[model samples]
Target: MSQLHALAAAAGVARTWQDADGRDQVVSDDALAAVLAALGYQADDDDAASASVAALSEEMSRPPAFLSVDIDAPLALPASLAAAEAAELTMEQGERRSLPIVRGVLPPIAEPGYHRLQIGEHALVLAVAPPRCLLPADLPGVARKRLWGTAIQIPSLHERPAPYGTFADLREAVRLFAARGADAVAISPVHALLSGGTSFYPYSPSSRLFLNAMLVDTSTADAGLSDQKEQELIDWPSGLASRQRELRRAFADLTPEQRQEIDAWSERQGSALHRQAVFDALSLHLDERDWRKWPADYAHPEAPGIAGFATEQTEEIAFHLFAQWLAERSLAAVQGEAKSGGMAIGLIADLAVGIDPAGSDAWALQGTMLTGLTIGAPPDPLGPDGQNWALTGFSPQDLRQSGFAPWIATLRAALRHAGGVRIDHAFGLARLWVVPEGRLASEGAYLSYPFADMLRIIALESHRAGAVVIGEDLGTRPPGFVEPVTDKGILGMRVLWFERNGNGFAPAEDFPAQAIAMTGTHDTATVAGWWTGRDIGWNRRLARGNWHNEETQRMADRSALWSAIGSGTPQPSADTPAPVVEAAIVQMGRTPSVLAIIPLEDLLGLEEQPNLPGTIDEHPNWRRRLSGPLADLLAEPATARRLAALIEARRA
Candidate 1:
């Protein structure tokens, strides 16, 4: 009823929201004013709220330059366009034709692409997308009715060769797993990370637009690599320096033809590649990690000074490009090996929802990305204080103005060489919790995006890539959101820990066919850890939450999980946990879901999960390396048995 509340709601801010504990908390006026300011509005009081509302009204009242719709779908235009008599449509490939705009709706596009629409003095970019993404059954020569995969955080895979494992180790995994009936290997975000002075976690990437330079193993030089010992935890800084030195050495050894090839690849990548290279080059001179903290002269990519800087530091920019090129070649070879080895879906790439606000993506995507606000989560049962990811995301308004090119670019990059792409926190496409800088996570507002348009773009990109699309659609979602994602042929992710039906685990067969079935995500506990309450113990030890009081509930969950797995009652304790680790895999394999991916941790029955949410230094997150080499994993009896059972069930 308050004027500030009205303006906040109108500006896509949730004034009152229900927390995970089922308690309603109203958004404070300060939070509203801060979030509104980030959105380019100013509302500190009732009068300011009215002014902000008026400003929004005035801005939105202008004619938009772009609109998006699915192919053959109704193209609804604004009321202002209702008076337009005729418009000229220009397709991407230079074809142009005039069509009538009848009753404010343009004719359904027969083709999907970026097309220009002209109505006298008004011109708009129209993005028409394909109906749905590539599906499992649509893959050429896919034998199994239901597909299955194994998900792993690549860097965490402990192998003898390459120390902390490399693209080379991952390549060998395809040949080994393809024979074992694993069609896909879902990886953590391989998006380019800041090589030096950054967290090793793959989720919080510097730039989703590029590849991690250090993951590329440029060698045959190290004959003793096969015998190299693995580390318990990845020393990212040292590892990156070692890999970069090797990559530089190889680059120096390249011939004229090889140099030309690198130059050609850079040219094809165009502006996006150059922009990122510029950002990386600038980092060498600037002490500040965030571009926001940099001198105003070089803060933005498109600034006049950036071009001069790029020219002055051509070699530095080239080094970054060379690194990306190496990573790309290695990644492409892995995917090629997967397909050649008879895998239907070679690799599944993970796409982090947002980019680091201080990273290359933020520098490049100035038009489409929002810098003043950070994406976060509302207060939830898992974390009572909520979570601040401290990442920047796309601006819904600017995305439309730019015709969603940045989004399209990001998606294409992820799906380029993968058999499937898993979108982390897919609910992000619908809406995001926006927190202003210096604000607590709980004091944020849910900002809405152009969900329908973004989904269509994703579907279009998915079809073009001929890759399956999987969305990690967990957390708070808008009503009827999952259905649309599934309907668009994008598989929704379902974890075992959350798929409860009336206080009991949902039956495997009851799992939806258009989804990805899994025991746990990287953010959750492993099957072995959850069974033994190791996750709860870690939480208590790390002082993350009040998990010490949830032993009874945690045990109850263990019993329900085993009961759902048809393993009678579970008597899980510290020393002797229930024998449901492999059973859990069996249950997941039995699901009617299109694909079931078992985490590597669960496959090895590791007590320590790959990642423990909410703690960095307090816990060993993203540090657990695999027990042995890629081939040794296949030799494991658990791997053999689980793969055999999963493949047999899917085949049947």
Candidate 2:
């Protein structure tokens, strides 16, 4: 079919250029001969020229946009004068490298001294000139020091009754973590989501710049709205409803002077106000659908109605901006408390790879975004079918040409109140699989980028912010991902489960010294779930076709392999408890990896993992709340002291 169409297209082009007879009634023989020859047809040929011509015409008529030129045009460089002039211009431009711009100020690190750094899978040896500090000098004076303090999830920490409301509860939670010897608390992404009965997933955020208004502690009254009692369990729907009602009542109760003050404050932060207006407009337009499915006008962000909507939603925009300000203030307070409580690294924030295609970042920077491609993963041993995240990412060419404004802006926001930033899917710096929209993930090809340039930008921004960077270099890492990251003083992620030797899992003592070691990530099963065979069982159930049987057999093989290790007697039914897993992880910390982060769930011996990969509704993903309150967790003296001792020993 394709060959027939190609012929038809060729015939059509030949026919178009054919000359007509002098009388203009019919084509000349010479012209017909020329057309036939151009279409690869011959007068004496046995082949059917008509069928070929018809096929070629059909192909040409289908779509002109699909046609492409195949040219290898060589550059015709000018001689002497022009060449010299071009060289001179190039030299002048090369000398004028653009200075790095600072968009926002970050609070400085407490101690700004040279510290030794180790990256998980990379090695570096620095030679310093006289009067300059050497790489060894930057190493911490003590061996096996931790990169940061303990971490807790904010949502889990404050999951209590309504009277102990959002912000008030968070305040108490922060204080609790500080007293518990935690220097940092890593929380879920708090980006804004679709309001009015939407999925409460913090990750699939509608806007990266705006704060999740749901996280706003309504107890902190704005414009005279008093806190109200409500049902427990952080009922998102009811909480948003109550908060909106209170906001309306507060607006009504505000005096003219108070209204004026609010208006003045909004006027002062014009950019933030404008962004909020745009976001509100988009929310109304999108209405639970991705922006690509919207009307053509709304699809292109710069279309006429976008700016007008921003102008109309002035007060609503101000409200959103106010919410962000409150969130910023609260986070800063938490950092201050952590610092006061003797935390070395106050907050370690996670940065998501990309935003929803219909998100604020994409809307505001449409030109910088890739319109037709979605970033995803290739098929691997763990995920045989491969995975598509359904999120839009910045094109490397566009990002580079735009001076990395979008990347810089996102980093600045995350690091503003964080002591360290963990870049999710950090391998994205090298290459990203760009699957065309509506295409399968397997069809995607790797698109390379200038990794060194990107890392330089990251290092520059991080250094300016005084924040350490931990690259999540898990999964199938690309060749040479470690070198530049380590050279730039960034840390690497080390997952104990995936750390293996040729025979089986590597011993904990063999783990790298410069990495941030962990038992598992949000995507993996918890210690209890892994022990009980729940994770493998879930995987088998989710497997497609005969894959289910294959996965089950694979699990059995893994069990047998574990038995061979002689670490413990294998149960016929997998049932390794949290204590065993915890002990293994503690032994991992005893390795060279300077930092270790134990999830609070593992420490508490929870039965379920925070998230189960490959299942959305089938598994309880991001919504799991801790069984006990923050105070109860702190009061668990034996558990707390034991974990603390491990951390201290690892640092030693």
Candidate 3:
């Protein structure tokens, strides 16, 4: 490719001019006309192209509005105080400074508390605690609450051809969870996926903010018209078809007065209605392909036909809004039920790093997104080939210029109906590995971001929402990742499988005090699967000739692993029963971490994982449904007592 093309591609631009230095430069109207001439377009007909170039230039200069924040002027210390505290004040990179003070300009120091100081456009904070310790009161928000949750895929709730089960089934699940002393249920993304069998993956959603209509329980609307007896199992496609049919019938049966009420409600939620409308239109147009393949005129948000399309899909859009409202109501009901039944926290939600590049958030906020690049992990022991999530992240510069609006918007949405939020790939807040278009994952490089500013935004939002934040700081973490975020009252994540210090699973006493301890995550094998050697066996088979890949190499490097506990046998199998693995995890619960979350699969002695990292279609990812009803699973004598004992011990 030409240098200009390379630069344009890197910047996620389709057409642009370049400076003499080969840098992609903002093209002037006249310069755009010259480029068009070179591309065979007549100069006399360049008015449209010239206007487009001018608009693009304007957008490049003015960043998104949401990323902006105001910082107050720094307090000027008196001459005497400056002289007295000269040794305590330290100058840092670029205009930032750390000083020892009772309190700066933001507020008066009340009992040696840390204060976040903002001076003009610069934002920094001071740690004003006692000599060596940090207290929760010194942080920006309330002390982080413990989060206990289980991961569930909304789509997996379906039996076969049906989309999802009845609301009654969901209610029963909540009731069963309460009986089992479970606090929260962490579910997969319920974002609307493309319908018509386009893509089954829930993560690659058509819209992030909207709820998936497939999950809606139509029985809650009008009971008698739907056949309650025939609903056997979840058949996603069939279930969706049945729900749609029932929804249409219910709409027909609605009186004119009822229709008016719905319309009035839609009018009140104007923005939500508009967003849903956009999603409906886009879903209809794209079918299965990405939005970029759409006709040229339709590509731009200001295209002539876009408004009409939005109008046409209004009712369908309203239906989507109604679905979200119902989901919120259902979730609240679950939380209330859990609380009344004696659970401490209810419904800790997981927030994925980024939306699918072809999804709604990316489409709506196109200008701010880093479109051509994909977010992925650096080479790690788990996946020697590394991982490219195929998701697009926001540009750091665009995020700052936009006042970090997209991040805030997403957090606010997740926190809206959640008790706590688990930030997947939380390390990305500090820096992300960005692989440019068509590049191998190894070619990716790290890009730094203003994490402190981002954390400040998160703290402010979470504090206001009365929700806790958990950072999933697993895998090869960067230097000093935990200390600052933990200091800010965000809890760290601890997985037993990876916890070790020159020996098998780190001693229970060594676990951190402010963390959520669990045996495994959605990406890893269940406790039973791990002990039985199923995870390693599967990895070995998949790796084939690359069997000695980096992951295996790491495992070889950690030969001391599992040795102290007396498992000298090299090749273990799934024949190892549940009780043994359960004991190991229960031991972890005795640690000082504020929270302990045991996956239901592990709790039930299941050998399968919810998801496998590298493979998508090859494995049954997000398809595993609970083998039995929640009530039945909770009633198993041994399972119930063991779990209850763990909860009791932890509570003590």
The most accurate candidate by lDDT is 1
Question: Which run of 10 residues does model 1 get worst, by summed lDDT?
Answer: 220-229
Best by TM-score: 1
Model 3 residue 489 lDDT? 73
Question: Candidate 3 on 565-632: residue-level lDDT in tens?
Answer: 32354533337545555565566557777777777777777788878878876667766666545666
- CA lDDT for candidate 2: 0.56
Order the candidates by lDDT, highest first — what do you get? 1, 3, 2
Candidate 2, RMSD to the unseen true structure: 14.3
Candidate 1 overall lDDT versus native: 0.80
What candidate 2 gets wrong by more than 4 Å, as runs, is 1-144, 147-151, 162-171, 195-197, 220-273, 285-289, 293-302, 540-576
Q: Against the true structure, what is every candidate's RMSD?
A: 2.2, 14.3, 10.2
**Positional deviation of residue 183's Cα in model 2 after best superposition, in angstroms:** 3.2
Lowest lDDT 10-mer window, candidate 3?
A: 85-94
Clash numbers, per candidate: 3, 14, 22
In angstroms, how far off is 436's CA in candidate 1? 1.0
Query: What lDDT score goes with residue 456 in model 2?
Result: 56
Task: Give the per-residue lDDT digits (tens) of candidate 1, residues 1-652.
Answer: 7777777777777787766556777888888889888888788778888888888777777778778888987787887676787889999898999988888878888899878888878888888888888888899987457888888777775444554667877887776778777788989888887655655678878899888877787764444444445567766666656566677788778888988899899999888888877787787667566787888889787777888888888877888888889889999999999999888898999999888887888877787888689998988887678789988899887887776778888998998889889998888888888899998998898888888888888887887888999888887666558777877888888899889999599988889988899989898888878877888888787666677677878767766776788556545454554357777888888898888898877777777887777777787777677767768876778767766766776676
Off by over 4 Å in 1: 1-3, 21-23, 158-160, 220-228, 567-578
